[model samples]
Target: MAEPSKSSSPAEQPRWQSGTGLAVGMSLGTALGLTVLDNLAVGLSLGVAVGLGLDALQARGSSTAPPQAAPTTPGAV
Candidate 1:
């Protein structure tokens, strides 16, 4: 069996690049506003804010940091 590369999976890709959080949030917000809140402006704004927050959180986690050199002690090779 051939081993798959970790980078080859689409599921591993970061979602913030696609703005999925915002879209989902907006959709839910619109629905909620129409059905319960009865305020389109408030709902959309809240949705966008929530979506941005989620996107930022996801983007932060997805950021790639440079690899650090292994620490070596004076006696260690």
Candidate 2:
């Protein structure tokens, strides 16, 4: 019988494993600070920008590999 393939699949990098919390915190803080400073527009914009930026960064770290189902063999039932 032929040996099973041994090549390692690309490992998935953990999400939010980097400076994600800092980014989120900074964004929220900036938004809240701006709101307190009577700059609603800037606060909203900053909050949205931060959310999108974090989303992009997080997406950059994760893999797209589909979850693989176990292989079924004949007469195994």
Candidate 3:
């Protein structure tokens, strides 16, 4: 039998994944906070927040995409 395709599985791919931006952001943020900021709580919180923010930004354009055309009504502006 042929082996399963690694690309189809998320766990197999090791490169920086677009879906993992939040995780990456959080880790980086936490690292920054712990070493430079010298605050565990702040570091963890900021890391999580940054991670969430990155996720949101990346997902912003995916769902609820902007309308292609402006309002058709004339003199409505």
Highest TM-score among the candidates is held by which one? 1
lDDT of 3 by residue, 54-75 (tens): 7677556444455344335655
Q: Counting only residues 3 or more apart in sequence or on different chains, how many pairs clash (N, Cα, C under 3 Å) in candidate 1?
A: 0
The collision pairs in model 1 are none
Evaluated at residue 10, the lDDT of candidate 2 is 29
| Local distance difference test values of all predictions, in order | 0.71, 0.59, 0.67
Task: Locate the minimum summed-lDDT window of 10 residues in model 2.
Answer: 5-14
TM-score of candidate 3 against the unseen true structure: 0.52
Winner by lDDT between candidate 3 and candidate 2: 3
Task: Identify the runs in model 2 with alpha carbons over 4 angstroms from their true place.
Answer: 1-36, 64-77
User: Considering TM-score, where higher is better, how would the candidates rank from best to worst?
Assistant: 1, 3, 2
User: How would you encode candidate 2's per-residue C-alpha lDDT over 1-77 as one tens digit per residue?
Assistant: 34453332223334445556456756785768676857766766676677667766565534443545567778879
What lDDT score is found at residue 44 in candidate 1? Answer: 90
lDDT of 1 by residue, 1-77 (tens): 33443442335665556688788789888888788899998889888888888777765665544444555567655
State in Å the error of residue 74, model 1: 22
| Structural RMSD, model 3 | 12.7
Where does candidate 3 stray beyond 4 Å? 1-19, 64-77
